[model samples]
Target: MKNLFPILLMLIIMVNASAHGGKNHEHANIFENLQGNNKAAILMVHFGTTHDDTRALTIDALNKKAQAEFPGVELREAYTARIVIKRLGERGIIKQKPQDVLAQLKKEGYTHILIQPSIIIDGVEMESLQKDVVEVQSQFKEIRIGDPLLYSPEDYEKLIDVLTKNIDSETAYIWVGHGTYDSNTAQYAMLDYMLKARGHTNCFVGTIEGYPSFDDMHQQLKASRLKKVVLVPLMFVAGEHAKNDIAEDWKNDLEKEGYSVEVKMEGLGQNPEVQDLYISHLKFKSAHRKIGIIEKKAIYEVTGEKME
Candidate 1:
C-alpha cells in the first residue's frame, strides 16, 4: 500500500478534478488573501440517508459543525443518492444535487466554492460526485474540493482515537462499514492495521460490501480468543446499514458463533473528534489552496493492497 500523499492525491484529484475543469497555476495558493467580492460557500456532499433520525444525528449534525466553524460562508447540502432524493421527492421534499447546488452558489455570486465530502473512503460514490462537479466548474469563479477523511495518516490515527474512545479495553470491537468493490476497499484493511498499531488489540474493522468481511471478523476474533464482541457501525450515519447490518445481522450471526455481542448504534459524525477532522479538511484548503493542486503536504499510506 502506497501512502504517499502526492500519488494518492493525484489519483483522487485526477478523478475529482476531472469534473471541475482545469486549474491554472496562477498563485500557488489561490486563497492566499481575499477580501472584497470574494465570497465562499461550503457544499457538504453526502450519500444521504432516508431515515430522518440518522440524518439529523449524522449529516445534519456534521453540517452544523461546518457552519459553526466557517461562520460567514454559506453551507449548502447535496446528496449523491438519487434513490433517497427520489423517495424524498415522493413525499414532497426536494433534495439538491451537488451540481445544482454549485450552480445556485454561482448565481448567488459566490466566487470561491469549497466542496467537502464526508466520505470515509475514496470510492465510487466519491467518483460520482466528482463527475457531477464537471458541469458547474466553469460556472463558478473558483472551485476546489477538500480531500476525503482518509487522505493522511494522521487522519487514521485520529480516527482510532475517536472511534475507540468509548470501547471497552477488554471487549473486542467489530466495526462494520459499507465497503466498496474497487481497490479503494483496501482502506478497511489499512484501517485495521492502524487500529492495531494504536495498540487496539480488541478492535477490528470490517465491511458489508468489501474485504475484511464479517467472516474475516469472526476468524480474527477467534484467533485472538475473544468471545465478547461489540458491534459498531463505521458509517457516518447510523441508518439501514448500521441498524440492520451491524446491530442486527452481524450481531445475530456473531452471537450464533458463541460470541456475546453488543451494539453501539452510533454514527461517525456523532463523535466530536470526527467532525473536527472534516472541519479541519475544509479549513486546511483555505490556507493551503495549493495543496493537491500544486504542493500536497499529506503523505499516503502504502498499503500492499493494490492501490493501482
Candidate 2:
C-alpha cells in the first residue's frame, strides 16, 4: 500500500504537468513568433464616436481581450469617423492619410496587418474601412489584409450564441444596431433572421437610423406585455446609445407610458465568445493564407458591394 502511494503521486504530477504544457502551447501558438520587425499587427478599426470616453472604453475592451489571447502580437486601434472628423475640422479638408498610420507600423517593423472593424452592420463606414485597407496594402510590400469582421455570416451566428448566454426566450432580447443609409440594411435582416432561427422568439433587432427603431420595439414590447427586456448593443462597445439612449432615455419614456420595464445593459463587446470569434477568424485566415484573400474578396462583394 505504501509503495502504491508513491506511484500514484508520480502519475498525478505527470498529469498536471501535461495539462499545464498544453495550455502554454496554446498561448504560444495564438501569439505566434515573429522575430525582429516581422510581427503581425492587428488594427481594430472602430466607427469612431464623438464621445472620447465611450470610444476609449469600447476599444480598450477589445484590445484587452486580444492582448490576453495573443500575448505577443502588436495591436492598434483607430476610429474612422472620429479621425476623419478631427482631420477635416482641424485641417480644413480630408487628407489622404494612410502614410501616417502605416509609417508608424512600418517603423515598428510590422509587415502583416489584420484589420478588424467594430462596425455592427455594413455601411459607408465599411466602405471607408476597405479604402483604408487598400491604401495600406499599397503602402506595405508584404502586407496581408484581413476581411472586416461583419463580412462573415458566421459572425451573425456567433452573435446569436453570445447573446444567448445572457438571455433566454422568456426575456425579450432587443439588439440596437447602427443602421446605414446604404444597402447594408440587409445585414440587420441577417441578424434578425439568425436570432429567430436560433429559437429566440422574444428577440428583435432594431437600428438607430433604420427600420424597427426603439419606438417600434417599445410598442411591441408594451403590447405583448413583456415586463423584462435585455438590451444588448449590436455594437463593439456599449457606447452612448447602449448606456444613455436605451437604458436611461428610452426606459424613462417607456415608464411614462405605464409599462413596467427592466433593462440589462450587457454589450456584445464584453462577451468573451465574441472575442473568441474574432480570434478564430484571425487564426483561420492566418492558417489558410492562399484561399484567405480570394474568400475575403468574395465575401466583400456580397456584403459590402453596393447595389445599383
Candidate 3:
C-alpha cells in the first residue's frame, strides 16, 4: 500500500504536466488559426510597358515586395499593356502570356487573391482594371479585390511622403503626370497642395498631355534662381518620358537655356514605400487572418477634407 501511494502521487503529477502542455499547444493553435487557414494569392496588375528594362524592373520590384511581406503567399503579375507584353515576349522578358500566368496561379493552392493595380491615378487604365477585377471576381468568388493604391485620397498622402524622401529644399521636384483632356484636373491639382504642405517652395507637378507643358517648365527653370532641379516621372514605369523626353530631349533645351539641370528619373513603383501601399491593401483584406497588422493605414485617405 505504501509503494502504491507514491506511484499514485507520481501519476497525478504526470497527468497535470501533460494537461498544462496540452493547453499551451492548443492556445498556440488557436492563435495561428485566428488569422485564418487559407493561403493568400497576390496578383500585381500593372499597366505594363513594352520597354523591356522598365517592365522587368517594375514587375521585379512588385514581386520582391510581395515576397518580403507575405512570404507564404503566392504572387503573380498581370499586365494591361498588351503591346508591351507582346514585345516583352519577343525580347524574352516574359515567357508566358498574362492568361497563362493566371492559370498557373489558380493551379497553386491560392484560395484568396488580392489584385493590386499600379496605375498612378484614376485614368483609363484604372477604370479598365476596375472592370477586369469585377469580371475576375465573378469568375473567382473566392478572390477579394483590394482598392488600387491611388483610388483614395489616403494613397496620395503616401505618394507625397514617398516623393518627399527623394527631394531636398535646394532642388525643385517636378513630377510628370499623364493627363487626359476630358477629365477634371483635380488629380494634378493635389500636387500643389501636397508640395506646399511639405514646405517645398520650388516644387511643381504637371501633365505630359494637357495643361502643364514643357514650355511652362522652361519658363520656370529660367526664372528660378535655385539652379538645381530633379525631374521624376510620376509614371509607374519611367518608359518613354524618362528615357527619351526628359533625360535626352529636355536636356538639350534646358542646357541651351543656360540652367544647369540635373535630371534623375526614378520609377514611382520602384520606391520601397510604394510597395507598402500594396501591403496595406493586403492587410485590409486579411485582417481576420492570423497575421498581425504591422502598420495601420500607413497612408490615410482624406476625403472632403480640405488640404491646406
Question: Which has the greatest TM-score?
Answer: 1
In candidate 1, what are the lDDT values of residues 6-39, reduced to their tens digit?
Answer: 6775646544442343232112243555568887
Model 2 per-residue lDDT tens digits across residues 17-127: 434433211122222545564667766666554544554455567667766766676777665665655854574643333435666887887776765665665677767
> Whole-model Cα lDDT per candidate?
0.78, 0.62, 0.62
Judge candidate 3 against the unseen true structure and give its global Cα lDDT, from 0 to 1: 0.62
lDDT digits (tens) for residues 48-165 of candidate 3: 7766677667767776777687787667878787777777788777744345555676576454566666767776776676666555555443554455666566777777777777
Cα lDDT, model 2, residue 96: 30
Which regions of candidate 3 deviate over 4 angstroms? 1-40, 51-56, 95-111, 216-225, 288-308
Worst 10 residues of 1 by lDDT: 299-308
Candidate 3 residue-wise lDDT at 138: 50
User: What is candidate 1's local distance difference test score?
Assistant: 0.78
- Report the number of the highest-lDDT candidate: 1
Model 3: weakest 10-residue lDDT segment is 291-300
TM-score of each: 0.83, 0.69, 0.70
For TM-score, candidate 2 versus 3, the one ahead is: 3
Candidate number with the higher lDDT (1 or 2):
1
